[model samples]
Target chain A: MLTAHKIKVFQSLDKKKFRQKYNLFLVEGNKTIKEIPNSHFKIREIFSLDPSEIPTGDFDTTKITPKDLKKISFLQHPKDSVAVCELGEEKFLANLPIQIVLDGIQDPGNLGTIIRLADWFGIPQIICSEDTVDLYNPKVIQASMGSFLRVNVVYRDLVEYLTHSDAAKIGTDMDGENLYHHKFPEKFNLILGNEGNGMRPETERLLTEKITIPRFGKSTESLNVSMATGIILGQIFSHKG
Target chain B: MLTAHKIKVFQSLDKKKFRQKYNLFLVEGNKTIKEIPNSHFKIREIFSLDPSEIPTGDFDTTKITPKDLKKISFLQHPKDSVAVCELGEEKFLANLPIQIVLDGIQDPGNLGTIIRLADWFGIPQIICSEDTVDLYNPKVIQASMGSFLRVNVVYRDLVEYLTHSDAAKIGTDMDGENLYHHKFPEKFNLILGNEGNGMRPETERLLTEKITIPRFGKSTESLNVSMATGIILGQIFSHKG
Candidate 1:
């Protein structure tokens, strides 16, 4: 039985302030709920309209009515299950072969897609500037499609992080060396910027090198940042083969 | 002069049946509206909250109040400028080095992103299955970020189009040649499938070859359709260099 207080708490998870206050985040959709047990995340509570939709686990689940579910669901088409997950302590694991650094990616979808791409390329960690979209944003989690469980994303001062890194700090620019010809170092930090503005001027100053995806067409001004990340990662991994 | 009937028509363009009845589409945002004069599509009308926001061209602009713009706007936050563009006759230009084919794609954002990727790589055309999301969806236009002005996307019966084409019909699958190793033909049709179900069995049968992006990670089941397209296109273009 979900009390009005519990409902209010679940609804609060949608905002970053509330999520940070409670140290909990929302995860909806039956498939994603099932994935939580295998990940490092701890599920504080699970609510489902249908009991069967809840994953087979030792955790307790509260069966809620459709009306109650509607009040707490974030999706336009709400799924059968929703979980309140405890935020894990993120560790910045340094010295990886390829570490993705996000300068200020504002779009939840773009951040989510980048996390998925990082997981696909077997990148274990991502370091983001403090201004980047919150990793626990419901849209980001939805777009990530469970890859958030595998990849570790930690927020830090980009200037401080880049300054301490001994590895190559590569930032993308339109006028930089062609990505096709640029050779990535064995250990490098690949930094992506915001959706509208590229990287912040201060952040761009720390770059050890700059690279670009050469445009084949005449009119398009730029590729979507997430698409650019995927294209660049594809080139990097193909060299290993 | 803005009239009530004109508002109804503009609002109606958000739906497919109404857009087809009028043979028109909505292009919003000041930046996207500016690109209209250079494209092949004709502007039926331009309405802007500020006349100065309208693109400088031989076209006439009708100044309207924000309240009037709100009724016809499809976005959450309405832009100053909106234009009704006439739908152009899309031509299927075959015998190109590479063409993109979308099979039952449902998301407008994915469609838009793919169109942008196609524009970035200089791929002129995208062939879509009849059931794919309509190209004129407001979300598709917004997500595309103006690439729709340059690329031609046409809807057709996949079986008929694939059967008639002499070029290699390539599909992506897990059990397939690693994209790093696959050699794409000079003239080929690259088909991306539905977000949830992937290619229909009938559609999959028409493929002349299958290629897969080798996953370096174990958890991610797959990449987003648009992201995969970018990764593959990146590989294809790098070989050209």
Candidate 2:
């Protein structure tokens, strides 16, 4: 059973300001919550329709009815469990082989999918523009399918981040060199831009190489940013191997 | 101006049965509606907040307020125009070199993203299991980003389709041969499975080859079906190049 006050706090975590204030975010669904035990993230609390479904952990879990779960769930169809987790300490790697940079990526689903892609390809860190969707957004967390637990996503001024990095800056463009032909460096930051627009002008200026996933069909304006990330990362990592 | 009767008709297109009955589907947003002119699809009618925004074409267009568009739009944030387009004839290639086969892919967004990916890789034809989300789904159309105009998506019974096909059949799995090392034949059907459960048992039985995108990171149970599709397609096509 959840107290009225507790429900408010869980609901408040949905917003960025509250998530920042509390330094916690909600992870819903059985698949995502199940991953929490193995992840480095600290568990604050767990609310579940079936307490048995909640993974045995150090965290406190409250058994709640489906109606109660629905009240606090951001998902349309609330899952078996929802867990409140502390936003783990940001451990930015001093030097990384391949880093992903997002320039003004706005969609939560896109951001989440990219984080999952980053995890799949062993890309550890993602640097997002300050304007990118909040990492804690429920949709991002849901779409990531627990990948948010693995990838380190940090939001910063992309221009400043690019300027400070010694790594080769690569960004995708419609007219850039075909990705298949372009040999990626041992260490590089591959920047993907906004869904509607490519990289921002400031970020574009810092790019040492502009690469493109060559389009074979005439009608496709652009691949979804997440899909583009997956394709590019697959090519780069596969080629290196 | 959209009459109540017309609004009812447009809203009905949101359902798969109604879309089939009318032989038309909604194409919302300025970007998608703009693509209709260049596409092979026949436009039934165009509704726009500003009629001038509708490209000069042979189709009949009506000027409607944003509120009218919202009533008829499947999108949460309605775009300027929503055009009704005929469900154009599916031109199945008799002997295709590379084709995409979807096995019970249910998510509209995933299906849409896959269609767009197929377009990007120059895969001209997509064969979807009857259980897959309808190709005419509004969310599929929205997420495809106009790739729906170029790619041919057809629905059929997977068992029958696979049994009849002479092309080599490939499916993805966690323990299958590493995709990077697998050699794809010129004429083959690349099968992507359902989001949660991968290829159905029946479909799995049909696969001549089961390939896996080697995962470099731990804790990720699976990639989102669409991202996996993008990564696998990118590797296969790039390797051939």
| Off by more than 4 A, model 2 | none
Say what the interface RMSD of candidate 1 is: 1.2
Fraction of true contacts reproduced, model 2? 0.69
lDDT of 2 at B86: 92
- Can you give the lDDT of residue A68 in candidate 1? 80
Model 2, residue B46: what's the lDDT?
92
Question: Candidate 1's C-alpha lDDT?
Answer: 0.89
Q: Give the per-residue lDDT of model 1 (tens digit) for B162-195.
A: 9999999999998989999999988999999999
How much lDDT does each candidate structure score? 0.89, 0.87
Docking class of 2: medium
- TM-score: model 2 vs. ground truth: 0.95
Query: CA shift at B92, candidate 2, in angstroms?
Result: 2.1
Candidate no. 1 TM-score: 0.97
